[model samples]
Target chain A: MNLIAFAILALLAATAVTVARMRDLWAAIMFTGIYSFLSASWMLILDAPDVAFTEAAVGAGIATVLMLSTLALTGKEERATTRSPLIPLLVVTVTGGALIYGTLDMPHFGDPSDPIHLYPNPSFVEKSQEDMHGLPNVVTAILASYRGYDTLGETTVVLTAGIAVILILRRDESHPEQQESP
Target chain B: MSIEQVVGLYNYWIVVFLMMTGFYIVIARTNLIKSIIGLNIFQTSVFLLYITMGRINGGTAPIIPAVVADAHAHAHPADAHATDGPAGHSLHETADELIYSNPLPSVLMLTAIVVGIATTALALALIVRIREEYGTVEEDEILELDRYS
Candidate 1:
């Protein structure tokens, strides 16, 4: 089990690095799909099957297709940035180090006694069954009932995004330049 | 601190590494599509981190019992033995005995995944419009062209 987890992590790391380094936009897009797939597998190992399902569907599936469509609209090859990569590299290093430092205070992975698992008020893992009216899937209960307002807001955001995209792209399509170029 | 602590927290280190790589990609890559991919990678790594935090090593998925044991209890209130005996299971016992994985983070991340995709769509749409207006998706090229125009 540990070996499998480590291997998935390694694969995720390797994919992320390759995506970072590769200048070919198409290959990088494919690698991003691979990265999402690996993370979904990791989510499965972590017992978040729902999250894994959503990630696989949204991240690897829909996002990739949208990216491909965008690629169709835009250039295929990425022009190498003439600016030095040093500043970004340094900034990422500092940010990563800070995040690692933050994790030191976090509860260890799968620790049952962790506040999220054992705590009663907000985490809701403890009394989700009772509080949510005997709904077996606590995630569903929490999302649909307990946190209904948040889910509603998320749905609204999605609707707004769709509208915004249509409004912007529809305007672009009427342009003579786009028709002439392609 | 110790080997045990490091071993237990190794998952977090992996999360950090993935986060950094994604962040670097977004910053360093000039292609609009590739930057969006980087953003996707960054968002996905975050979901992994949240899911990892909620896991229990030996826990099962959060699901209700297979059979409706409560109906039997209702039919024969006097003989409460069915609820406890080997023949039939108790409704409460299903929840009480099982060490179910935490579902809260999974729920939150599900919404996040949806939002992430929506944002990606919007971003791609904007990239398309940018390509139409500026005739290029590379940041440097767009900046140069826009400045001259």
Candidate 2:
């Protein structure tokens, strides 16, 4: 299991690097899809199949399509920039180093004694069984029932994003000539 | 570090590396669309981090098996001895034996994944509009055009 996890992480890292370096927007978007698919596989390894399903559907599927359509409307190749990369490189290195340091005290991967497994009084798994009356999927019970308001808020966010997209992209029919490319 | 320590912590280190790569792309790259791609990468790495934290060594997915759930449902109304037959007793035993990975993170990440996609879609729409108005998606050129105007 560790070996498989390592391999997937390696592939994920490779894809991220490739996406960062690629000049062609289309190729970069394709590589991003591959990265998302690999992330879904890793989530499955971590025992989060619900999250894996969502990541595969939303991340790899919808996001990739959106990016490709955006690419079609924009330039295919990124123009070469004269700006120096040293500052951004330095900033990222510092932030990453701090995050790695923060992980030192984190529980070992998959340690059952971790606080997340034993917290909030009965934990979500046991509580869901009681509150949800033997619901087969604890994650769904938590999302749709126990945490209903949170889900409702997320739905509202999605709705707002859709409306914002429509407002931004919809052509003005009253002035047809204004719709022409400048 | 020892092998065990290295094994325990390497996952987090790699995730951080992936995140930094994305951050570098977002900050250093000139293209607006590439920045959005970088943002997606950054978001995904954070999702992986949360899911990684929720794993249990021997745990299965957080979904209860159908037979076990059926046994639970049956056992709820009456005492196990009164409600369960021989097969149901075994299913009850199996349910007691099962260990599930943390469902809270899975629940949170599910919502996050949907929100991330929505954010991506909105950003892409903005990028398309920016392209239509400015005739280029490169950040530096857009700023130069603004400066001259």
Candidate 3:
């Protein structure tokens, strides 16, 4: 099990590096899809089946398609960037070092006595076990019932985004000069 | 560090590396679509981080025993008393067998994933419009055109 996890992590790292270096937008898009697939598999190995499903469907499926459609409208290969990468590289290094430092204080992987599981999670589980709501999938129960308002807000965001996209794209089609989009 | 601590911390380190890779791509890439890809990568790394945190060693998926399922299967419409006793007892019994994974992070990620796709779609749509007006999606190129005109 540990070996499988390690292999997946290694593969994920390799793919991210490849995606970063690849200049062909389409190839990078494909690699990003592969990256999502690998991450979804890792999510399953981590016992998060719901998140795995979402990652597969949304990340690999929908996000890839959206990116492809955008690619059809844009240049296939990126023009060489003129800006020196030194500044961004330095920024990433410092930010990543800070994040790693923060993780040093976090609960170790799968530590049973972690305070997260000690308090809030168990309370949520207890709520799931309540007689009024005997939900089998605790994730679904929390998403739909306990945190229904938050999910509702997310849905509203989705709705707003869809409207904004339609409004933006629809204006182009109506333009006399812009007859069709490739 | 000991082997145990390394094993515990390695997952987090991998997550941070992926996050930085995505962040660098967004910062360095000039193409709008590539930046969006970088944004997707950044969001995905976050999802992975959450799911990784929720996993418990030897824990199964977070699915509780279905009390209603058991009740319906055993109750013959006349065994109300027998069903009642088991239904109440089953809930308590679940705690004994509850070696299930944490569900909170998974739930949160579900909504995040939906929002991510929606935002990606919107970004792509705007990119398409930009291509129509500016004749390019390269940020520097578009800005250059804007400067001249």
Candidate 4:
């Protein structure tokens, strides 16, 4: 509708195309940062300032920087001729499409009259004194108290990934490579 | 329909298309950095999804002014008159003033973004060590040496 939104959409599309066609890995990494910034702009246009902030900081800022760092350690040239991955592509396409289609049955974007409002959350704001949790933000209360178990699971996932990374990149102190004297 | 609904809707579709394609690249391709790029796309699409969900119809920026903030103040039972209509109107105004927003997904998204950054950082660190150990970072090179080892 607005110029800003149009610019963001254009940039988003261009970044996707560039990322796809990019031969150099570092250029693709740079475009990933551009893509993230455009996505954050779209988020801001959608009226979620908090989400916009996080997307800009984490998605564009930290994530892009780290990815580029990895690229620096690795070679920039992508494989010249990779094998055709038809089967995996088909599987991923089907699964992702089904999920996107399923999201269509969800409430329209930003509809004021949605099931989200019909939840017990309104009661928390209605009777703040009655809420046993002292948190002012209902979302925090729900995440930390009501759905505490799910958060614990997420923490465990992070822990598992950390352990896996350590194992994958473990040191070779016992078997040092033989060096020749100059 | 407003232009927001018309053009804005397609914006979501583009994100989804790019996202799925990028994810396909990650899952199908063997290159580590390519997989990371694909993961970036996947994460960006989710941010789009959350931001789209948070957009409110007929809603202005959420900054609250001190005077206008009083509009949301609720009246206790003691302050109520013996009339039901005025009480009902007061209650309606209070609820309406504090517009119902689903902040849960957005809050969760914030945590997700942080976790995404952490993962990326850890992944990069691993790649550095992987390069040191293997003398190369390409998947084919690593696999070639791995097969022989």
TM-score of chain A of each: 0.87, 0.92, 0.89, 0.69
User: Between the candidate structures 3 and 4, which one is better when assessed by lDDT?
Assistant: 3
DockQ measured for candidate 1: 0.44
Candidate 1 TM-score to native: 0.87
lDDT per residue (tens digit) for residues A3-31 in model 1: 99889988999999999999888888898
lDDT of 2 by residue, A108-158 (tens): 887776777656533445446666766789889989998999999999999
Candidate 1: misplaced stretches above 4 Å? A121-134, A172-182, B67-94
Candidate 1 per-residue lDDT, tens place, B1-149, comes to: 88978977888899889888889988987778878888888888888888888887788766545343244334545543323333222222344466677778898999999998999899999999988877888888888887887
Error of 2 at A51 (Å): 0.9
lDDT of 1 at A104: 84
- Which stretches of candidate 4 lie above 4 Å from their native place? A1-3, A85-93, A123-182, B1-12, B60-64, B71-101
Ranking by TM-score: 2, 3, 1, 4
Clash tally for model 3? 0
- What lDDT score is found at residue A99 in candidate 2? 92
Model number with the top DockQ? 2
Report residue B104 deviation for candidate 1 (angstroms).
0.5
Write candidate 3's Cα lDDT for B22-109 as tens digits.
9999999898888998988899999988888887777877876676435533444443233333222322233445577778889999
lDDT of 1 at A152: 99
Second chain of candidate 1: TM-score?
0.81
- The per-residue C-alpha lDDT of model 3 at residue B143 equals 91
DockQ of 3: 0.46
CAPRI-style grade of the A/B interface in model 2: acceptable
